[model samples]
Target: SPTTANLLLPRLATDRAAMAASASAPPHSLLLAAVALAALASVAAARDENGVYDPCSDTRIQRGDGFSFGIAFATLGAFYSGGSVQLSPCDRRLSLASSGQLAVFRPKVDEISLLTINTTTGFNPATAGGYMVAFAGRKYAARSVPTFVSNSSYTVSSFTLVLEFNKGRLQNLHWKKDGCGACAKSSSLVCIGKQTCAFRTQSCKSQGPVDCSIGIQLAFSGTDKHESVLNSWYEVSNLRQYSLYGLYSNLKDTLSGQFNKFF
Candidate 1:
């Protein structure tokens, strides 16, 4: 079979090359070649299973290192309305339901941070249902349950997405609501339904000095599959979760300076 033959090519080539070299090589040289060949074969076998690079299948993240993944934003209508179980965001079949906007972020573990996406023209989420999902991992495909970001009433600017890991592998992702408390002190922020702080799309720029950009803060928690103990990445980092406003202020100042270029 073509598939079987393709899979065996690496081993076959190594065997043939080794046989040709054995005639001139000493015993130790032959032994070293055999070891090298075995290593190559093992690597090939591993790659055979790994196949192409799919962000959904990525499970390699070092302890103390930040992770990278994608976020898809769309209207409620963009998702399947059927009663069937929700599919992983990384599923190719999801293209039908997720032909919306995607934003990728690589955030350090346990760090409270903000990311802003500026548009040349005004940004509006009202046309869409203003929902988003964060997703990563393959064999352990993890997707945060859908979260509402905007509507005709308001657009959320601050959010926290927690990544859960167990045994060094990502297990799940979920949204942690701030109940608008993080933005309570700032006169510039508007609390929406007490679930989030948002900028009213109609008067976002008029209500505050800040630009109308979407911001998300990331964190990590929980343990991986079937684990009782929580992952230490979040706890050990001693994150100041409320620092999101400070970070947002810095980002806003920097963005304001270059507002002319964006517009």
Candidate 2:
């Protein structure tokens, strides 16, 4: 019945009714549910022989095409043990428990999108663990360096995640911090401890806002599978550091307003 259970994972993650049921499910069922929800976010773009989408396959992504993927947030103990780190969240050795969470985002190739994750109860990176992993297919996965999400003084709300591809395959995922430069200058934002930009929870809207949700500015870099040099999307965009905040805010508002029904 493992296969049947796996088939139910996505529903448990996205469906409110199923989610309520899962609160009382067994531990193993919860683990599969977490993995299923994370993996299913992106699998709709590709599939294997069984007509099931395997997140481990090496699929080619074309320019201008949109694809979905997941980011898993867990404690250091869940991902690292014996003084070593797990490469992929898909590994059987990894245990994704209730303490862990997943955020799914669908972004177009060569374009930047603002991705948000709603944590109704509020997420304390210091306590919940600031580690995250970005994964698509099994072969296209990367763990981010531990990012300090919040401290007693402030909570950093915005970040930039760069997906680097080489020859049409994902090579690495990088998290770039702005060192609070943009936030310090913005009249609407605040700089936290001179380390990062933050949004005050009081200033955020109850429905959805950067302060209430984790916001990631997603962008793609590197060459596609074709290995062609003519169309370098990253280079064409010419993204500057200071410009990122404006772009992130604009996209965040547009997406939140347009897709609030689903999220």
Candidate 3:
């Protein structure tokens, strides 16, 4: 009864709030969106793209029969908080760099053009059967790292960075060793000192001559599933390249994109 009560209460409360809000709404567009979102909390609602009704407010996600899931940012260097989401039945995991809030997750699969605009392969949800999911960070300074199992095939075609401070800059754009030492070329990626190791034989690759003066570019690679770490820091630290420095307390931001199954 407690579990049932728990589920029913949130929906009831959400409905009440939606009704109250709608009674005094201003803009048609805003009111329409609010009503559409509230409808998702109903028990009679249909299943979402992930094949589950309601939302994944639950923290833990099961492997669900070893189904391969993935995340592609609408833009690179998007902001998210700390803690990682385990993609069970596999060594792969998704990390929210700084915040731990699930900001946006669509219930149903919808066709969109953003996926195609950025990815070279031109992924469309109508064709790919993938849905969008997103997470946001606190308001100040943070980074997002969607780390995957090294050697696991993936592509980071395009993503957007929603930085709290407009002056924020792309700090690092390279793969680093989960192990110690500067991951030299053609060397075995060690994990003795690190929490996890990179690909078996993959080494850290740098994006040479990045022009922040012009804009940020998300380097694309098809074969590497190495831990691609992207760091975001205050631009005022022009000379000092330190992760410890230039950190903030209340950084608010979000990043969204699709996790379509790649065939």
Query: Between the candidate structures 1 and 3, which one is better when assessed by TM-score?
Result: 1
State candidate 3's TM-score. Answer: 0.17
TM-score to native of every candidate shown: 0.63, 0.64, 0.17
Q: lDDT per residue, candidate 2, 27-131, as tens digits?
A: 222212221111111112322122112333345665655444556666666766454866555554566655665554445555545555544334445445556
- Pairs that collide in candidate 1 are 56-137, 56-138, 57-138, 75-129, 165-224, 166-224
List runs of model 3 lying over 4 Å from the truth: 1-56, 59-70, 80-263
- Displacement of residue 90 (Cα, Å) in model 3 is 23
Write the number of the candidate with greater lDDT, choosing between 1 and 3: 1
Q: Estimate every model's Cα lDDT from 0 to 1.
A: 0.50, 0.50, 0.20
Instruction: Give a tens-digit lDDT track for model 1, residues 186-256.
Output: 56568877777776665565444556556555555654233443433353244445455453466455554
What overall lDDT, based on C-alpha atoms, would model 2 receive against the true structure? 0.50
Relative to the unseen true structure, what is the C-alpha lDDT of residue 10 in candidate 3, on a scale of 0 to 100? Answer: 16
Once fitted onto the true fold, the runs of candidate 1 whose alpha carbons sit more than 4 angstroms away are 1-54, 64-66, 81-84, 96-98, 110-112, 119-123, 182-189, 205-210, 222-241, 256-263
